[model samples]
Structure formats: C-alpha cells, structure tokens
Target: RWRIGYAPESWDACLNWARARKIPEALLETAGLVVRTDDGRVYDRFRDRLMFSICDEQGRVVAFSGRILTADKEQAKYVNSPETPIFQKGKLLFALDKARRAIIEAKFAVVCEGQVDTIACHEAGLEHVVAPQGTALTEHHARILKRYADEVVLMFDADTAGQNAAMRSAEPLLAAGLVIRVATLPGEHDPDSFLKANGVEPLQEIITAAPGFFTFYLERLTKLHDARTDRGKLQIAQQIVEWIAKVPHAVLRASQLQQTAMKLGVPESALQQELRQYRQRDRTVATPAETTAPAEDPGHPAETLLLQLMLTDERVVPLVQQQLAADWLSTGTAAELMRKVLRLHAAAAWNGHTSLLGADASDEAHRLVTRLLEEKRPAPERIPAAAGDCLAALKRAALERQFQAIKLRLAQPGLSGNEVTALQQQILDLRRNLDHIPRLSVWRSAKP
Candidate 1:
C-alpha cells in the first residue's frame, strides 16, 4: 500500500511533526518534503492536501502527488514533489508498486488519467489500475507495463484533453508491440465520478467492452468526418493508411490494410496501393512520419492512387507512363517514384523501394510480384474511370468543404443565434444527404 497521509492547514505542522520524531529538518529539504524560499524561510511543499506516496517497484516511497482541497483559481489542482534522487516523474507509473500482482493476474493493465481515478478503481475491486503521474505515457512507461501485462486499457475521461492523452498514448504502446484498447466514460465524467455514479459493475462493463486501437480510432474518425462522400471516405482512408504504414511489421500491415479496405467498402488492392504511395512519399521526407489524430490533408489522393497502381501493377505503370504529359498531380514526389519503379522493373533491379530511395514500402509489390509481373492485376482498363471518380469526388468535396467551413466558424469566439442555428441546420442537412457510415460497436470483451 502507498503511504497515504495528510498535511494540515498550517505549513509548520509537517516541520513540527518531523521535529517531534527527531527527524532532521535538513533531511526533509533533501527529500523534497519541504521547500526553501529565496528569502530563507522553509515550509512544507504540500500543505492543506491529501498526500499519496509515489513508490518504486520495491514499494519504497520515492515521491508524492498532493491533491489540493480547494478550487483555488490561482493554484494548480494537484501539486507534485520536485524531482529527487529516487523519483523521476516521467519514469514511473503511480500505484505500479501495489498494482503489479493484480496486473499479472489480470494479464492486462488499466491506465487511468488521474491519480484519484487510480485510487477509485482500486477501491472498487479493480486493483490493476495505474496512472502516469506528472507526465504523458512514455516509452519508459510502456516498457514497464509490458513487464507485468501484455495489454493496456486506457480509462481516460471523455473530456478533450483526456481523450487526446489516450490517443497520444497508443504510439508508445504500439512501438513497444503491446496491445492497446481505449475505454471512455460518458459526458464530463472522470473515472472517479463514473465509479461513484454507476457503481463498479457498469464501469467495469465498459472497460471490459473496450475496442482495439484501430476500431476505436476508426469509429472516432467517422463521427468527426463525413463518411458519406468520396472526399470524406478518402480522408478517413488516408488517415488509417498513415497509421497502418507506421506498423513495424509487413505482414501485419497487409492484414490491417485488408481489414480496413473491407470496412471502407473499397478494394484491398486500392488501399494497398495507397499505402505504397504513403511509403514512397514518407521516405523522402526528413520529418518523422508520426500519425496523431487524422487531420485534413489536401494532397491529391487520385494522383497518388495512379502512382501506387503503377508501382505494383505493370499494367497501370504504363498507363501513367503514356500520360506523363498531363498534370493531374500536384507534386512530383509520386511521379518520380513511379519513374523509379519503372526503371527498377526494366533493369530487372526490381528489389524493394529501399533499393531506389532507402525507404520501406508495403508488401503488395513484394508479395504480389508474380501477379504483377504476370499482368494479372485487377481492372487495368478502369484506370481512366478512376479519373472520372476523382472528378466526381471533386464535386462532392464542395459539400465537405462547406461542412468544414461551418466547423471553422463554430470554433470562432461568438456567434449570433440565427447564425448558429443556420450552421447547425446545414450540418444536419449534410448529415442527412451523406450516407451514414455504420459505427462498429462489437468489441472483444475483457474479463469483468
């Protein structure tokens, strides 16, 4: 158990308590239990607060997170002890010392966004809960979690900041090759309030029903963007492709692409082609190809599609080659890539993309080289029809552009009542006009 205790209203209470026990005042300063002002006065670092000891794996108290009692505007809601010899905030997860056995038994860890939520879960018989104290979930935290469990369930608040934290956390977990699921509380409820409001069973039920990272994020993207139109569909597809491309394994990437394409009602070949283009373009950039929440990318999706088709399909490669004079593409990045792919094929140097640009590509070229070289890829004649679809997507994109414009206006500080209603109605009409993309609710349940 953590060394749960309290500090009184008066700053001197801790100092006096230490003196009565004959604990040296200098030791308190060194331990980060007290702070020395520039004017030479010494006082407790955590006053009028509930103090929870942060412990190491051996259950040694190395730091403290102090929760303030009042809603004081000037002060932070929580205060933590400064870095000391034993504790580095970013390097430790709260309650891990106590949660280790429970985590091992559960075979999965629940990561909460708050220390109080961690305590609340523990009290309600969910003993495997932990929190990232004073920092976001890091690679260090991921490695630590992997020691006890193979998966992490992120029980973050429904608020924007908490949801964003949950999203950011998936990276380190994936990079560490650990399975990640996200569980959310309704409305403005944090885990502590949700537990008290609904009791443990309902809260536990939600966590048990949390979805894997892909299903979780894809559903979120559906809500945030219109899935009814071609533009919206491609936007969502591009975002999913970005994250899928980041997956460290090739076979895994292909499998994810197959599943995503199925869900989007698109050909697996198209998504595979999209990912191939993402890889080629990603290779040339100096910036890290990190995928956060998918935002709008204005890149021409059709041109990239053609380029990818060329890279993988010998049929489509000549289609792009014959029409090199026309410029439907905005950037030469993908065009240059197709040319390289062509030369690679002609020279019989058709190795991986790494051979040309020192970058990794999807497995379609490697896996289906026999199909491609044999001229057996699907629908090479429809390459021109795709141009028609791009033109139609442009027409439909006007609605998407209008929808996004309304969203931008909604973000502005103040608006008149009629303006807000008109905007809301426009969104309602757009929603009705667009085909409703079904959200996935069937998720694998964890142990209750």
Candidate 2:
C-alpha cells in the first residue's frame, strides 16, 4: 500500500522541498531516493507510476515495486528500489506483514509466482498470500513461511515454465522443513486469470486439491520418464529416492519409499535399501582440490552384491547373518553397514532393508544402499549360488583376520608356552578353513 504523499515523484519538487526544509545532500544520497544523471543533474528515481510499497515483516516500508504508467519501448516494464541499508530483495517476501496472521490462523500460506498474482489472491479473499520479489523462491522465503505456516502451497501459472518454477521452489522449501504442496490451475490460466474467470470458489478448490510435495514430485517425474521398461523404472526409482532424501524426516521418507515402490512397480524392500544410499549421497561434500574420481573400496563390490542378493531374496539373510560375525563386519565401512543391516533384520525391524522405516540410518549407510540399488540385480536362478559364494568369502575373510590376530598375539614375549602352542594350532586351523572356502565370483554371474 503505497501512500501518494510519502515521497515527491518529481525531481524539482523534491529539490524544492529539500532546500526549503534544509535537508542534507548526504542523507538523500544514502537513502537511494534520487539518481545523478550523466550531466550531473539529479532526478527522482520513481515517477508517474503505480508504486507498491514493500515492507518488512514489522510493517515498516523499506522499498517499492513500481509499474510503468505508460508503455514505452525503451523503458523496462517495472522497476524496483535498489538494494539499500534496509532492503535486500532475497530477504523480503511481498505482503508478509499483512499475511502473517492470516497464514498462521489458516495454518498454510499461498505463494504466488509474482506480485500481481499475490495482489489478485488477496483481493479474491485469500489473505494468506505472498510473492517473491522478481526472483525464484529462496531459502529465506522458505524460512519466512516456516515461521507462520505448516504448509505452503505454490500457485504458479499452469504452464510448462510455471510448473518448472514450482518444482524448483520445492527443494528449498522442503530443505527448510516445511510441508509443500502444489496448486496447479487448469490450462494456461494463472492465479489472477483463474480467479477472474471462475471466481474464488473454484480457485480455492484448486488450492485445496493441491498435491503434497512428494506426490507432486512423483507425478512430475513420472511424466518425464517412461516406467514401462526396467531401465526406465530403475531410473525413475533413483530420481524418486533422491527427491525423498531431500525430505528431512525419516518417517516421511519411509512412507514415501512405499509409495515410490508402488508407483514404479519396484519392490518396497529394494526402495528402502536404496533410500539409505540416496540420503548418504545427498549429504556428501567434495573437496575443491580433488578432481579425479573417488577411489573405490575393494570390499564394496562383494559387500554390496551380498546385500543386493539379500534385498532380492530375504531368505538368504539368516544364512548370511550366521556366517558374518561382529568382529568380521568391523573390517570396512561396507562391513560395518552390513552389521547394522543384519542386526536390524534380526530384530525384525528390517524386511530386506526396506522395512526399517523407523531406524535412523547414517549417511554412510545410505550411500552404500544407493549404490546397491543402482547395481544389476542377481538373476533369480543364480541368487542361491551367489549367496553361497558371498557367504564363503565373508567367512574366509573372517578366518584370515582371526589367523592374523593369533600370529600377532604369538609375537608378544609375555605369552606362556601353552598359549603360544594354542595360538599356532588355531592359526593352522584357520588357514585350513580358508583353503576349503569357495572363490566367490558372484559379481560376474550377477549381471543383469
């Protein structure tokens, strides 16, 4: 709400008033109220326009958005106040001062894509409406909404570009820990046009029917990728899991995992396992000095492949668990992850890794799960053999570790004669067991 007399719109008028009132030049310059021309003449920055006062949440006017009064090819359509001491475009949301209470009472906020859209929604009786000032929705906007609203519905234009914009806004909003929904109008209509054509009732209906953030993401990505083929389905699953990782709530993510599995026609267990990995990748930060690919851990292939087999066939889990001891799983990051998976499975909290919806998994565990999800699934016929081979490999590694420990113990001078003999015999037995174990070529046979 810009008041007409708050500031003079003409250069001469402002100059005359300032001189008559003895206003300081430095104060006027610092306020960004006037522009100095090429010839050293000062002029009013805003003139003959419909000015909209932009205020902070405390209801103090800090800047303005001014629309052109008359069409001019050389003139831009709109002009905004330059950044000043009190104004930063990214930090302000238009109409927040007026909409705060309404948003809190309603328990939701309506975020339109532009200032006109915000104005239209407000006049149409939707009071809890706000808009970003000529920029994409930022984390600041999301933070502002999070303060007064449980959810924020995006009511951008119903066009391809508008849909894209809404989608883009979703990540920051979710990252800010706010529940997001999308209100898509029919055809090419925007909030303003829809309200004009169908009035507030229909417009409200559209908002009421808006999909939740994850649901909107699934629908949007589904259209972009064909899920009829296995590869398409896998790709869609990866995208959905990645998006779900953006959701900060593990409970919410677990529920979305089921929905994603059903939507992509993949196993819920596989998705659950993959969700862990996706979350890990989302949390990963790379160093600026590193340019080459990250070094691959030698144990990852076997460990992940074993998890993949167990993910596809739950019956192998018990047998795999029996062969892997707590000390054996302490060998590598992958081994440690498998230990958690085995422990969860034993407690009935994990159903092929997908059922542990409530278990808070670490980022490293998630990264491992995601890698497994992307790998080729073992053929149904080969699962048994692959599981057996992986089991043997795990066992042999465990024995070899034990044998090394025994030899290290034998190196100490404090060891008794009987203790040294016992250690040597145990080492011999471990070596014999290692020789009898099968070579697990499970990776070669598990190709898609």
Candidate 3:
C-alpha cells in the first residue's frame, strides 16, 4: 500500500556494513532491508556485535536491534533503529507481526526480552511470542499485547536485575487488568539457548513451573537475606512486613502475610503486631517536624491532622507523594505501605476505600480506617482545645512502639555503636515531641 526506497542502492553495500567488523552477514542484510544509510554509518551503528532484526507484521524488516559482543566494556549491549520513516520503537512490537496470528489463535503470548528468543519460541512450537525493542515493557506494550490475548506469559532472564524488572513491569500490567504469569529460565540461559540445548519439553516444563509474581518475589528475598540467624530473621521479618504493607489488595496481602509467617516459622499474630508497629512509626514521622530528632512520632493531633487531610482534602495527597519519593519519611513498615498506596493511587490503580487497605491490613488496619472515618471532627471553635489531647495520644503510642523495637534490637548480643546511638536518639526525640504537647504539662514540668 506504500512505496519504500533504499539509499545504499544495492544489497552489497548493506553486506559490506555487516562485514566491516565482527557483525555477521545475515544480521547486516536484515539491517539493510530495514534502513539505507547513504553516509556509510550503518556499520558504525551495529559495528562489533550480534544484530537482531526487528520485523513488522508481514515479517518485513523495520528496524535492527543489535547487541555488542566484543570486550569493550564502554559500549551498551543493546542498540536499535534510529527513528526513520519505517521505525518507531514505541509504536512497534518486537516480533508481534510474525506471531500475531498465532497469538490471536492461541489466546496467549510468550513475551521474552530479545529477538533470538522470539525465534526460538516459534521453533519450539510455542509460536505466540514477542519482545520489546531494546527496552523494558511499557504501558503501550501491555495494551498492544492484551488486544490479542487475555493472558501474557512473561519469560525474563533468571537474574536479580531481571527479577526486579519483572516486579516493576507487573505494576503497570496489573493496573491495566492483564493476567501475567512470570517464567524464568534455569541458571543463566535465556530462552533461545535454553531451548536449543534442553529441547522444547524442558523449556515448557520451566514455563509450567513458573510462580506467581508475589511468590517469586518472596523467594528471591529469602535467598538474598539469611533467615536462619536471629538478626537475619528480624531483618527478614522487617523486610517482609514492608513488602506486605505495600500490596494494595487486603485479602491477597493478608494471605501472603500468613504464608510468609509460616515460612519464617513465626506466629501470624507476632508478625501482624510487628507490621502494625512498623506502619504506625512510619505515619508518625511523615508529618512535618521542628527537628530531625532520631525519628519519633509527632503525636495524635498531628496524626489526626494527617489523616483528616489525607481523607478529606485531595491536595494533601501530592504533598505525601512528594515526601515519600524524596525518602524523607522513615524507612519503616508503615512508611513502605504508605509509599506503595500513594504510588498505586498516583498510577490510577486505586479505586475506592477498599483499595486503600493494603496487604498488611488486618483487624488493626480496619480499626485505624474506621477511626479515621468515624472520629468526631473537632469544631472550629474547639480546634485549639482538642488538638493537644489528640496529639498527646499519638505521641504516646509512637514512643512505646519505638522503645519496644529498640529494646528488642539491643537485647541481641552484638549491637553496633551506630545502632546504640540511633536507639538513644529515638528515645530522646520521642520524649522531646511528647514534651511539646500541653496535655503532657506534668511531664514537661518534671523535666529540667
């Protein structure tokens, strides 16, 4: 339906571009068919690497995504089309043109990370395959894939970076209402190499064994931190609590929390308490403070002010968002949960009151939400009178929780000087914040 032209004039010129360096002829031909470089710079574009031809629906070349092979550590491994008339990286799906019909027929697509991997999937009889062009999966990519199928089988590399990428990708995909199953190749092998050696049966088995994103994420975390030692177990508990706090689904999150507790050989009630304390500390410190005083709660009045603003005035959401992104909030379970909630809301995934209750929410979370919604608002006339009482209650709760965590940590045999100093500072700050409350006048009078 459209006219296409070439500037190199002949296939030989294209072949020369590939042959000038370590690039292979097939890759160069693929590049030539996609683009014509009159300036003879096509070779420079793919100069010393393995080339991946990005094709359109008809299998016609549209762009070239090449990977660097030589020992030069300075160069990036992935390179792609330079925005010509035929190629727009964002608009194109890596191998969808070849696999679209199959994807539509099969009702699923095996999404990988590279060109060769797509070819390997097809060769293995799993014809519905596609990948991104030298980029991570984006919203646009998810929408395009969702058009053909209800589910996407994500097969990424089995590495730390890949796992992290998959987790991030899940957010956007899940937000878009896509069903995603995450799969990883064994060891360091990618789909292409893995399929070539182990045969299709082995690759299929790996796909069958793929775990849900949450399960995989937890497994990855367990592998990263030691859970056998007391300190290790404490750290893991803290980390898992944070993770659970961020999950937007209450039911899903609670289930995950129970499972995580069982795996760590701890009581669910204990884990729930730990997470609750963590969140309370987080919300307490997020409020504006007069000084950086070892991270104590700002008091009930401040917390009420925050909750009131958060629920009643939408404008405060952005302020919370800014503080969270800036990392000014304390690094605790509650802070993590708040950050996740705000992030999901920002991304437009948060729908209603239910969505506000994250994974760590239990009867305690329900109580907090109920209190925020049902608490009697102080009259404008009585605002000053009521503020002190509320602030005092919040401060006490924060101080008690912080002292408990510190006591537990200190009870361990080998407390570092930094840790000891941190605990002392927190206690002092809690006392200081509490002293500012007028209702704590007796305590203030007792102090020097």
Report per-prediction Cα RMSD to one decimal: 22.3, 25.3, 18.6
Q: List TM-score per model, in order.
A: 0.61, 0.59, 0.48
lDDT for model 3 comes to 0.61
Error of 1 at 350 (Å): 49
**Between candidates 1 and 2, the TM-score winner:** 1
Candidate 2 ranges with C-alpha deviation above 4 Å: 1-21, 37-41, 71-74, 282-448
Q: Record all residue pairs in model 2 with backbone atoms less than 3 Å apart, i.e. clashing.
A: 276-366, 277-366, 277-367, 277-370
lDDT of 2 by residue, 123-231 (tens): 8889999998877888767766765666999989989899889988888898977888898889999999888899999988888999887788788788878888888
**Per-residue lDDT of candidate 1, residues 271-387 (tens digit):** 989988998887667355463434544445444454445555445544443333222233234433554564454334566444544436445434433343444223556545553
Q: Please give the lDDT score at residue 23 for candidate 3.
A: 76
Better of 2 and 3 by TM-score: 2
- Each candidate's clash count: 0, 4, 7
Runs of candidate 1 exceeding 4 Å displacement: 19-26, 287-448
Best TM-score among the predictions, by candidate number: 1
Better of 1 and 3 by lDDT: 1
The number of the candidate with the highest lDDT is: 2
